[model samples]
Target chain A: MKKVRTKQVIPLFMAGFAVVFGWVGVFKLGFWNPDQGPAPGFFPSIMAVVMFLTSILAFIQSFKEDGTVKYEKQELLVIASGAGIILSTFIIGLVGSCFLYIILWLKVFEKASWKDTLIILAVVAFIVIGVFGLWLGIQFPLGLMEYIL
Target chain B: MQNLQLLLHGFQTALTFQNVGAALIGAVLGLIVGAMPGIGSLAGVALLLPLTYKFNPTTAIIMLGALYYSNMYGGSFSAILLNIPGDSPAIMTALDGYPMASKKKRPGQALLTADLSSFIGGSIGICILTFTGPALANLGLKFGPSEMTALLLIAMTSISWLVGENPTKGVVITMFGIILASIGMDTLSGVPRYDFGNMYLLGGIPFTPYIIGAVGFSQVIKLIMERDQGKGGAATDMKLTIRGSMITKHDFRRLLPPALRSGFLGTFIGVLPGAGATTGSFMGYAVQKKMKSEEELGTGAIEGIASCEAANNAAAAGAFAPLLALGIPGSGTGAVLLGGLMMWGLNPGPLLFTNEPDFTWGLIASLFLSNILTLAIAVCVIPFLLKILSVPVKYMIPCITVVCVVGSYSSSYSMYGVLIMFLSGIAGYLLDKNDYPTAPMLLSFVLAPLLESNMRKAFIISGGSLDIFFTRPITCVLMVVFFGVVATPVVKSMMKNKTAGKASK
Candidate 1:
């Protein structure tokens, strides 16, 4: 119950940020001019205000919350590392950086055998490049070196 | 008779060598992808979108539609054998399906059960589609923008009922999705909303990346998170056969009624925007539970499998109704198809019927063939597909991740899309940790813009009169249905508690 209530805090804070973000965005960007039916910034600004209000409600509701919610910490590490892998892939090529991250994740964090990890990693990398890159023609950045070559 | 004539013409177009070839290719690929554990029909369709650019508009729509329908049929194979459903629609099947497999001396009996049920259900669904889709398309002929908006509202509100235990949380999540969708430039006006000084945000948050991120990437990431659990092997020593004796007359008697009834329910629910096979299958199973003999449920009953397969397959066909008629897509696959049609320079609406009857009819005709082909392929090749499931999860997760990354990037060749995929993965991880349902969030994200735009459009056209929703007959009917959907669950729960109290007293 406490965890469930606490979870409301995140969405509420995000919602508050949305409100501030919207207000600033609309003011900075301005609404549609004549010959335009609605401004691009118009909906975002409106959403920001709505999100902010809802977040406030969520936050208030969190304080008086009475339900049981379990907070599991194990998942947070995966979240951070997984996001890092994706962000890093854009900087490095699909094969190199993604391999480093997967190895680190599977062996170091999850504690699998090096043989098991390396074998799966190599096969997966090959398949990803072969199927998606070669067959489907998805331009997954092999990074600067490949691009320059 | 008139409808039959048009349908016959449709069959002529569909039966040609080129179109028949497309349906065959679509069925084979869709079944393969669907039978795979992690990848789903939605992903399969999305992955194939880039290829559709090469085909003519009608051929592309027909091919993609075939893939979508077959994936739904194919998902049940994994459910019966593995007990882990390939997709959400297959969840109910896994309940009794796996149990039946264990009980029978021949575990392959479970696999055969699923294949036969899929055949029965899919055929019935296609028959319904042939008879009813044109009539519904005709009804759509009368819908104006206001009515369209009302229909969209019904879709949006209906999410609360379909989502998890908390209706309020579902609504909040849906509202947030709407707000997220509203980011970037206003479609009606060129002004940027929450661009935050980035030119890239001008296109708004691309729905595809978010989908890949939230559902696809997150799922892969979680597999990484739980890599140690590893995968179990498919049951060996089970001789699976598709013989007549296995699916005897008694078995057909058990299966046919549920298959037909669920086909209708699935089609009806599927026609409603934002409702898809998941709800259709669940509702079908729930209804079957009530009508079933106490002796046969959750024991690998053929009826149980038929109910789910029929509704889900029908729902796949039914989802096209709103997309074809109102230019509104009810689910992710429908949304992707809508995008494909628009990319092909074909606008989907009532105007479509008048402007391009051949293309429209061709796509409908192709479905009839696709349904027949799915059964043919499954009966022939499902045993072979089962072999792929034995590959280790540790190995599979990395492959799934690669697919996720490539799938996300393929949506747009932008670096930002990859970033969105990553961020959505993390957010998906967090939501999973908190036990918050992702389906509501994903569904809301898909339908949010339609709901908002239609609402704004309706209000504007009515000169800000709220009565527009009540005053228009179609709108009024849709609104009533929306409220009814929201209230039905609550009423049922209350009645259940009252019954329990009476029994205790």
Candidate 2:
């Protein structure tokens, strides 16, 4: 498989953004309203058009430069860790998810000693649950805990 | 006399035990946070803002303001000791400061110079704020919608041009921010524009979560990616001895002039919307370097550290001038503070003085104490802070990520906010990687609503005519400045090309 060029990514992203913003501006929010001084969609629709034009210019400019993505194992692991943390938040709630993430990230990704992992887990849990949860009285989704309690 | 009386009154409010305690805590935490990599004062302030929700406006502002200024002080510590600038503003400090610490073996002198310069610059900046803030606020009161729109336009353009090498990317990112800001119901009309189908869209995307994700979480990801790299070895064998003999009388005399000059220059730059501490510090360093022979600079010259440190601290204070007076944030951190002020149910601008004198004055007064406290705490805690730097990158990454997740969740008490934060983090990372300046986007996001609302107001008043922006004297001047800011670089590039053509011929 051919790797995507880094220089091309931005122009592509910009083009995609323009399409979405333009579609939303015209279809979802009407282009204009005569009764109102300026319609709700006026600014957004203008922005969409500007973005579309600028992105074309950027695309043309990008063709002159050549730079490709260099995928590395460490970078892939970091990306996976970010995704894992986000997915875990919905599954176990913030406090619980943080605990799971810290353990997995330390033991699996970083390959730290189990003792170090456990110490980190304990300290993180204490702060999240004790300081934020109990003291601040901030609420969070208790995915598994909700069913158990 | 009037200013003095107001300042004394401000001190009275700030001197309360609770306020004093909050200031101290804020200073210490700000120092620690600023000393850490991947989280500067802007992220530090944004992450901690939710915790200030319960406090009164005065106490909250005092704490945040103290945190904001002391963060500047803390940034220099890591810059000097480890050549790793904890924040952009401290980058200049690292150039000369690291050399002083490592090669000259005068780390203590370098730290002391930075601390003293910061304190002196900050104190002068506060004095400037006290006298100028109200007068500027009075002037701001005269500005109507037209003037406001023009001013905001100038600010957006200037920031976009000045911040990064790629002006086109900056402008595009800024437009994106404005588009994001226009997501909720239109302020003038009751009609919802970009809700798509969700009920949550009506209330608009919350600022806190987006900021936390963009500034805080994105940094966490970057740090995690680089976790395997060894920490800079500069701080290992550092020994600090704080004595008068460290910086001789001759050194002090030589440093004082540059420090004083840079302090004023930084303060002036800070008052301008979109110009920040980083710009001020760089400009100060450039001017100081230009004055001396090339050999004197980048060689641990005391003047180099003094000028940069003074300017950056003064710029932090100068940033408050526009914020307090015109409700326009002068820097990215100022933008965050503006959001916090709005959250606290206080409208910034001229009316804030009349509406919440105690809050305004208390914040100003706290600045004085925060700087002094920062100096004392930084000097005493040098050993402890150095220890913090030794903590492995892997440990810091996970801890910060958890904090970001929890902080985002706590802000709105909604899963949606967390999702937005995570997505914003990804967006921020991509944007940063692509060299699209995030500060312009953040600034535009903060200012978009104001600009749109005022533009609409001007149109309504002028019966849908665009002439209002050009008719009013102040508005006309602002519009001209806006055009000047946008055109200057284009003209300069054209001239450069022409010069090269001539030389080739």
Candidate 3:
């Protein structure tokens, strides 16, 4: 059996999506309308066919390459932190979640001293809250805190 | 004369107190970001894009435009001082700049050469854009749906050049971008597309946050993964004062010729679809290699530094023409600016020249202002910019991440934008690791909607017949060229095989 490397997975995933697009485009969405114009799915159908063919070509070409991608521990930790911040935003709001995420990453991963970490934290908070919120007037996600208040 | 009057009017608009302040802030921020080793202009613009949301359309664009133009000047600072290039366009600058600095012991002069040539080249590019912009827009006004579709097709094919080593991979990424863009509601019919039953999907992915996440947040991930990669080179102990940076008359004469030549060449290249400043610099350097130089090319030569540095700055200026005239972004940074135009409630096609002359002319005028401001500021702040290089990557990663989060959230005032940002950041990182270029994806995302709209319009005009693409004279020529571009590599490979078979026999 032939083995696909991690690099090949990107194309395969694209191919998988292409199949779904093509399927839905033809049966559910419709490709051509009675107005002799394109329906909602017309463009998607064209893209689906092209993407499917190109992804297969990419898959075939990936066999010429060597080595699977190795994910480092640091990358995973960073991604986890990103996910944590994102999930926490639903509860604590953007400003709060970012405050927690940044503080933890600096203290734990970077091993920064409290002095430096706090300074960085203070600057970051001022920029996010003072500059972005107060200065620009962008309304951020209130999360569960809005209801609680 | 007509363009000149319009340009003077534009300068009047750009010289306003608020606009001038915006331009100044953009210039300083641009230099800071451009001097930083890993962050390119794409990310820099994306990070700061949120700041301009509150400003008026003209003011906002002038800020972004100045930021984008000054970025080219900033890229050369690190390239000359250290061996590392701040951006891809500066890669050629580093070839001669580093040796000129360290080996020739003229670190100050090397930077000054880059600044001077950048100034000259950028002036030429801005001049060309001022005249060409309205003419191009006038020409574009003649393009019907069929002609527009063909022109966009040619533009779309340019993505193949950015695909890196794998053409197939480029196609995959381009298609993926189109698919992503198609996820929102269908504009014509008001029907939802590829939304997966999510409410946010109906609104589509936010462009600014997507850009910030893909370009900025992904860099943060890379910094974390390779903690030791951001090390600064030995840059201390050099007399970096403006007086110490002056070049001799003979050296200036040598630099002037190459800078002038590359200025014209780079501007034309920048106007081409997807070529941008990186290719402009490379081609400029390549041409200079055949010409006579005062010193051997690439080993501390003034000509070598001038050629690429000038070309890149010119190309950055030239990219605005297509963006303003055709509503087509000539580079990734231009795509971000195009997205900004959409967000600002302005249409950016052929009508832009007639409809919004102040906005168009003001942006063009600001480039000239930025060219001067950047040169003076770049020369004065070399000592300050060098300090930014020493700030540890660990510190940079967190600050940049917070900015990315906040910027994403601000784009649409929701968590949905942030979620898309994180997801695309992962996708961007993966693409970067595997040698798949992210630029083509972003460009495709911006172009797909326009292309789809035009093509559908052409079909509507043609009554569902395919001849609409081939029947019109201008469309015929563009389509023919598009086919030729697509077929050349395939034909060349076939010829190579035939020759190989004959040789084996």
Pick the winner on DockQ between candidates 1 and 2. Answer: 2
Residue B319's lDDT in candidate 1: 78
What would the per-residue lDDT of candidate 1 be over residues B1-505, giving only the tens digit for each residue?
7657776887887888888888888888788666544456777788888887988887888889899988886777656654445566776676567566544433355555666666666666566656676466455445655676666555555555434654444545655676678777766545566677788887777765676566656665555544455442333344334442155676668778888888777787677655578767766776786585434665667777778788888888877877876688878888988998999999998687658877877888888788888778877764564444445555656555655555556666776777777787767666655455565666666566665566656666666567888998988897887677668768999999999999999
Q: What is the lDDT of residue B308 in candidate 1?
A: 77
* Residues B1-505, model 3: lDDT tens digits: 9889999999999999999899998998788666554456887788778879999999999899888888898888867764445666776787688778756767778888998999999999999999886564344345677876776676677666556677788888989888888888888778898888989988998775676666666767876854564433223444445665678998899999999999998887677656678767866876687589888876889999999889999999888888888898877788999999999999998889889999999989988888888898988876564443345567667776777788777656788888887888898888878778776777677668867888888898898998988888889998998798779779999999999999999
- Candidate 1 chain B has its poorest 10 consecutive residues by lDDT at B236-245
**Pairs with steric clashes in candidate 2:** none
Best by TM-score: 2
Please, what is the TM-score per model?
A: 0.71, 0.72, 0.71
| Pairs with backbone N, CA or C atoms under 3 Å apart (clashes), candidate 1 | A1-A67, A1-A68, A1-A69, A4-A69, A32-A39, A40-B186, A40-B191, A41-B192, A41-B193
Evaluate model 1 with DockQ and give the value.
0.31
| Candidate 1 residue-wise lDDT at A38 | 38
| lDDT score, candidate 1 | 0.67
Task: List, residue by residue over B176-236, the lDDT tens digit for candidate 2.
Answer: 7778888878887778867877888887887766766676677666666656653423343
Error of 2 at B152 (Å): 1.9
Instruction: Choose 1 or 3, whichever is better by DockQ.
Output: 3
Interface RMSD of each: 3.8, 2.6, 2.2
B-chain TM-score, every candidate?
A: 0.68, 0.64, 0.63
| Each candidate's DockQ | 0.31, 0.45, 0.54
